[model samples]
Target: MMKSKSKILVLDDDPNIVEVIVTRLESMDFNVHGFTDPGKALDALRKDSYCVLVTDQKMPEMDGMVVLREAKKIDPDVEVIILTAYGSIEGAVRAIKEGAYDYISKPFEPLELVTKIEKAIEKRELKQRVRFLEQEVGDSIEYRIYAESPAMKRTLAIARQVSDSDSTVLIQGESGTGKELIARMIHYESRRKRRKFVVMDCGATPPSLIESELFGYVRGAFTGAIKDKRGIIEEADMGTLFLDEIGNISPEMQTRLLRVLESGEFRRVGELKPKQVDIRVLAATNADLEAKVEDGSFRPDLYYRLKVISIKLPSLRERKEDIPGLVQIFLSEFSRKTGKKIMGIDKRAMNMLFNHQWPGNVRELKNIIESAVVLCKGTTIGPDEILLSGIREQKEENLNTLESQEKNLVIQALKKANWVQKDAAAILGISRRVINYKIKKYNIRPEKVN
Candidate 1:
């Protein structure tokens, strides 16, 4: 298709050359568009994205130099390769000066041209990856390292210790407790750090879509499957796959995933042939898999297979000692993000944050700080800038009101369920997702009730 990432635009005045090049690249799994006219090739460049431009130096309309310049304007990232006459140093040098990636001499081996195109693709990807990593660092490196509390220190220690192992790890915690962060820490510290660390939020993804997303599908796997597709598992073949909300998946889906864990081989959707992968799996869930297994909603065998090692993250309220450190880190982080010179939080705001129930945990704290930084007119954030239906407002409201009653009801159910969200949801006749949302909404916890 025109929008495919691996598409190549091949332009040669000679129809035979275009045909040969297109056939070769197509055989190697590239989506290629061949054009004999310089005008038509330029039009195609405007129409779709292409990874490389392979163009002829000698043309009646315009030379490869002109085509290269035009292609660069269309897509600055497009790598260009000029087709030059044998021993034509002038043309090659001109092409390079004009920003062509490389030049291929006429009558060159098809394999040689393929080799250069591969390198051009590699160079382009390297540049894009560096840019992506820069953005990630700017966004998250701020609060990722704060371990001021003993609970947090213990959690991080377990993560670091398991970085050297290849066993499956089950991370248990409440939502917004940075389970993915811990998983990322394990992956980036491991031997496969250079490879991809693929993540899938199993709870957010629908049961109907889970199969094809995890194992991928071969061409003609189903009616709408136009081409072979790589799933999240395939993308993380040599590295790690972090499945969040693992307990939310269906019984049938769990069996399929268990196959991948027990054996490295898995069959893609509608494909008979089994493919193998080498990957360490790390699964996280706020839901209690032990409770689910007891109820027969989650398979016991699959649960055991995934929990070779386990780490439980404490809620923000349990580790309130880290609040100030976390707030300062977030202040600096959001200051950089919003281009604000915010210096600090006032004592009242800091006190409010410290005393808040923090039902949404560290993630809630980060969001509140980001919001405050945006609203902050001066260098310091005051009490009013700390926006929430939190402790500040809770103190000002009546205990007998609907909001108060609802908060008490949630905490009562939570205590009865032993703080397991899935069990608590069952007790309240609500979905686990709903209870999770209500927890964040009302900021409910036992410590806040008294």
Candidate 2:
């Protein structure tokens, strides 16, 4: 798909420089609007929303830094990148501290400028998404697992179809993919809807206490068992038990849980008699249980038993098309809670959101939007309102090609160094830290490099 281009606001007093940048960026598929006058560019800033604002450091009436500051007042979320000459490095750093996304040194490479611009746009979009989610999902009673993409629609359909069943279901996806919400939906829509639905995070509990907590104990069973207690399983007898982060369970806990699944019975501590319950099991994990099984961290039998039916939630990056809708919903939500009358997002901000690789998924998106809404002073959110400068640090791409540069570099290094970390780092003239980071970031296989 030809991804939608982010809008670029180019401000420079020199018509020639403005013309060159506009043609170059537009040729790269960006939507570019330029102004040779700082005042005119500020007018454009007030009238239109831009994903990125590129301005010259030294202008006739007003400097680029001054223009950028004013541009932020008009639209806080708009990303600003300054173009600085040789001696203006200090000024560029000051601009960065004042909220500019990046600075391009004069006489820079076309490729380098393009990479920085791409990163700036990506960072801006991430901020906008975070703002939208925070604003929309925080206060709504009709909370939905929002997904308009085909892949997400399919997953939602599967979730709905299996929600009413008594069978155990395993939800697999990366963290922030809304596994808990899916589990809640299943319980809410099931035959046991009116009964209590208890959640137990296997990953949170200490291994020593997981057994006593899940299958309670009699009075004086242990040091803290001064009174008789109802276990989580008993507490949720006619309801549903949500086992979150299921892959983190220890082998011993897995065995105990396995027995419960098989017999629907568990005995309290210090009691010989077994108690029977009719609770349904719904488990979720971001880990690959199958891979864990291969490595013996998880039991194969337990994995099979829990995964009678599995639903995998797609990552946020895999469903970029749904971002626009998600953003709107979040805006309304945050505006209500924060008492901010924020009305809408700038078109350019929305474009940036659709291009970001959201490593943190929906949860991260919600946090970003909430932060922006809290910090915003107007009815509309602009690019600078979102804090996404660090997002680019984690991106695997060259910020331009998404694939070419890093992939090729890793492959070449692996070939020359026989895939050894120290050797590869030496071949690339970078630290082992950088090499290791790249290897993981690109999911590169040294074994396959040759």
TM-score of each: 0.65, 0.57
lDDT of 1: 0.81
Per-candidate clash tally: 0, 20
Alpha-carbon RMSD of each model: 9.4, 28.6
Let me know the TM-score candidate 1 reaches against the reference structure. Answer: 0.65
Candidate 2 positional error at 243, Å: 0.2
Model 2 residue 189 CA deviation (Å) reads 1.7
> Which stretches of model 1 miss by more than 4 angstroms?
1-143, 387-450
The regions of model 2 sitting more than 4 angstroms off are 1-142, 388-395, 398-450
lDDT of 2 by residue, 1-450 (tens): 111346788888888888888888888888889988888787766544467889999988998878888989878988998999998799999999999998999877777877888888778766865665464345454357787899899998998899878999999987667888888787778877656678887766766888888888776789978755667887677679999889877888899899999989888888888877788999999777889999989989999999999999998889887787778777888888888899887876666566656655776566557666877878877776753311222345453553454456556556646678887665444457656767887888845655
For all candidates in order, the CA lDDT equals 0.81, 0.77
